[model samples]
Target: MNDFDIKMIKKLILKGQWLLSEHALDKLLERNLRIVDVLTSILNGEILEDYPDDPRGHSCLILGKKDNKYIHTVCGFQNKSLVIITSYIPELPKWIDERTRGGKYHE
Candidate 1:
């Protein structure tokens, strides 16, 4: 939840020290998104939520913008590298808009 994790993630990403899990890769392909998009988003985005106590590991939801479009990325750190847990374009019902959540998704 703190800035350190996000900073570490950004650092790892900037240095090409990140990995995309199988699930994350699948999500990216399904959305027709490129690694560039994910990296760009992470680099330009801000952390909206943090999951420091996730059973899986510490992670966060980052909302980023590019060319007037929005993308959301879930990231975590492991094995001294940043892991892309998942990424997608936030959509209706769940998102009222790019900056607002329409529901309590974590709960």
Candidate 2:
């Protein structure tokens, strides 16, 4: 999205100021994803979509890779901190590529 959002996300990662939502944590565990995997993905990923008008405030979808598999992370801002809304591996029948979904380019 904007430089400020990107900078804040990076800062959150560097300072360990982000937290996973309960639902997000559950999904990670259900999908056998590790916290480090999600973090690494975010640290090295690219923003795929932006939702500045999200009811929860500004947020974005990030696409990242881990172990050759692609991971999608939904990040949002809350109380001056970054929140991991959700994280999951991209699946077929929905995702067309690492940066696309349902025939639409997310980038």
For TM-score, the strongest prediction is: 1
Off by over 4 Å in 1: 1-4, 104-107
RMSD of 2: 2.9
Provide the RMSD of all predictions against the true structure, rounded to 1 decimal: 2.3, 2.9
lDDT of 1: 0.83
| Tens-digit per-residue lDDT, 1-107, candidate 2 | 33336656877898988888998999999999998999988888888888877787777988887778789999886676789999988876578667767544333
Task: Please identify model 2 stretches exceeding 4 Å from their true place.
Answer: 1-4, 103-107
Task: Supply every candidate's count of residue pairs whose N, Cα or C atoms clash at under 3 angstroms.
Answer: 0, 0
Q: How well is each residue in 1-107 modelled by candidate 1, as lDDT tens digits?
A: 33445677777888999889999999989999888888898888888888888899778899887677799998887777788899989888788888777876624
- Candidate 2 local distance difference test against the native: 0.81
Worst 10 residues of 1 by lDDT: 1-10
